[model samples]
Target: MSNDILRLNIPPEEPNLDPNTVCKTYPELSQEQYSLCFEHPDVTASAIQGIQVAIHECQHQLKEYRWNCSSLEKKNKNPHASPLLERGYKETAFAYAISAAGVTHQVAKACSLGKLKSCGCDMSLHGKIRQKWEWGGCSHNVEFGEDFSKKFLDSKERKARDIHGRINIHNNRAGRLAVIKNVNRQCKCHGMSGSCELRTCWKATPEFREVGKRLRRKYEKARKVDILNKATARYRRIRKQTRRTELVYYERSPNYCDPNPLVDSPGTSGRLCNKTSDGVDNCETLCCGRGYNTLRVRRTERCDCKFHWCCYVVCQTCHYNEWVTVCK
Candidate 1:
């Protein structure tokens, strides 16, 4: 596709904002806007490369949000889904974002150099398309079905086995400490220097040393058995929980940009509602909106003197209450 066919107005310079940062900041663009921006070279080539990068980043954020929302919905329905699936979703999303970012960078680079070819139709950002395919392939392979569950279970089993081995080591250390204490006590009773006798006695008297070695081995074996038993019990409990607990994988929904209150009321309080009422009077006073309280009154005289009974609704975000009345 020729970049000229779209006849995009090329800006002299790209915006100063970082595309990655902007995408990370606002995670609520719709899928259509995201696709349109990236797929149509004209959309990005028209603006300075930096502006194009920003728009591309916005598209990535949008895709991420939608993926999250979808994943969440799936998890809600099936609580025992495979965790691998969730991991796959995250990996895939990240891969997609990175690929998209790369493509945006490349396109920006091309446009900046004035080497961009005008395409007759919307040209696929080549780098991003390749990334999408790679990530999508990974996502597909991470299948959350029976095979995935088996692998997940196998991993847990291996971890449990490792824990058992560690428990055995701890038990062995405890047993060794006990034997060393006993040996020291015996040496003290024999009037032998602790370290000197412990080192020499074992070497000089092969029979005595062999007996001690056998005893130590027995103690270690018993301790290991006990540790294994305890570990087995713990593992059983963990396995039971793992088998019963559902692993849900839900895609997070993209957050929609909060509609500008001035342009279109979000059917609720404005962003100003988030402001602290430190200087405002009656900051603690409740507002009519959801969870939104008015600033605390600075003085009794400052309190509204109107004598109408009003309903108080809490602002979902701020938990402040404001007064509202339905016209009779």
Candidate 2:
């Protein structure tokens, strides 16, 4: 998290050399570095913005390294779940790398006096390159749960190969001088060069360094805790819950019977009827021998019965005019 600027010796390249030829020799230049050369430096602005961007990107790389290391260590304790942990590391690393590059580009543009321009590379070039590195090439071939240290070492090798090519191109005398002048101007603009007498800006403050360090530590701790807690919670939920297979049976009351069954009998033609020794009279009565009572009793008996397919059942009251049989 140190804000101390590390001075890189970026001497001018040979003036007679071709930029394309030099670029061809080194394929390792990350998108961030290439962008610096192509955008701000190619224009009138100081390339120091690019260097600062590189520093920011380096910090991101360092943070990613720490995160990955922590993940690997955590996974080691759970050897059975190492593959998933490794995948997490790779996915996080790829996303972080891409995001860091983009942020660096944005910060460079914001800090610089000039605007961002296309590096003459195709609009899709950055995306394509990132895909190749992250999905198709070495990054993809790396196995999860294997030797993470060796995988990191291989990554470093690939990065070194890429950087060597880019630096060689920037080594050209004219390009180097241009970059140096641009950087010097940028430094002076920020009052970090010549008679300005300021050693560094607020960006290089100790408070900022401490903040960055504390934030990174907190993020790492939170991430680890979250991973562990989520996994445990999921496992506990799965273990505590049981799977069911039987259909839920609901016992429903029959709709045939009523407390006042004879009140509205169809046999009465919407009127209360009473048959007694006195005479036929319009009166309500509870008689079991009534025609409406017989119908109600029969319906209730039918409703109380239960039938199932693929079973043996012979209806004792099979006196219905129309009957159907089904076999399972």
Candidate 3:
């Protein structure tokens, strides 16, 4: 993952551009990935969407923490070029995992929605006889997502012959595993009116927030590992001891309290914080003890609404002022 696939481009205006047109269209994707993009444009769009989901979820999960995923939001600059991803810190581990999981979730859900020609409903469950429940509904084709992610997302990291590359690959797989683990088993009754004799079941994608929560927990307990060669005895022992679902890191995180040019971290200066709580989002912790400033701000929103007999509802605009805290 030297570069971010978030930069993958296929301009809407140029619908008939040549596949070999300057390579700028897919500067981030490998040859194989871009090749598929030319054939399956829908999949490429879905991949981008998956990354967007990952970014949104990442921001949501880290909203109250330092290094709150704001680097992925730099305008005009390549967001993937953020230093947040270059190191083997716990945040990097979570980034790789969540991005991979996001791709899996979107791709699988796309299959169920008939959005791709190459993939469709997962028939693996359709004919299976598992006790009382029969596979009936369209199950998410996670296998397709896993394969696409491996081919597309894993392409770059597979070329690197270093430990960081290995870390990215591991975290990527861990993220996909997180999505797979959260796949829900949905069932419906197929028996007589009031009798419970048989049931219909389908595998569905669980809420992406659940995946984020699981990865956040793993980030809290991420393990540090150092191994250059899989042929060595220590590597074997560590691999044997560590579960694949767990996140692994190689280096300690940077001081996120202050701006670090090396890692492109923006200090928490002026960031909103909760002054009344003793938590990660509190001014003391988030501001790095630099104190904070209080300000009264007013904002407006739709307030009271009333529905007419056969028409739309009317609402009144309301403005209110509230005191806010910002890191100094």
All candidates' TM-scores? 0.15, 0.21, 0.81
Candidate 2's displacement at residue 253, Å, is 63
Computed on alpha carbons, the lDDT of every model, listed in order, comes to 0.26, 0.24, 0.74
Kindly give the number of clashing pairs for every candidate: 54, 11, 0
Write one digit per residue (lDDT tens) for candidate 3, span 1-328: 1112233343433323334432344445566667777776666556655765687688888989988887775433434456777777888888889889988988888878886767998998697878887888899999998888777677777776466776788889999999987788988876679465887889998888899999999988999886565333244455676789999886778769888878878889978899888878999999999999999978676544432111123457899789889899
Model 3 ranges with Cα > 4 A deviation: 1-27, 75-79, 190-198, 227-238, 299-321
Evaluate model 2: give its TM-score.
0.21
Top candidate when judged by TM-score against the true structure:
3
Clashes of 1: 54
Candidate 2 per-residue lDDT, tens place, 1-328, comes to: 1111212122223211123422232234445444433433322122222223323433443331312222212211311122321222222322222222222222233232222232221122122322113111111111110122112112323354432211111111111122122221111112434544332211111122232343233223321111233223332232233211101111111221122222211122222223332322312222222332211111111111221110111223333332221111
Clashing pairs in 3: none
lDDT (Cα, 0-100) at 242 in candidate 2? 20
Q: Which wins on TM-score, candidate 1 or candidate 2? A: 2
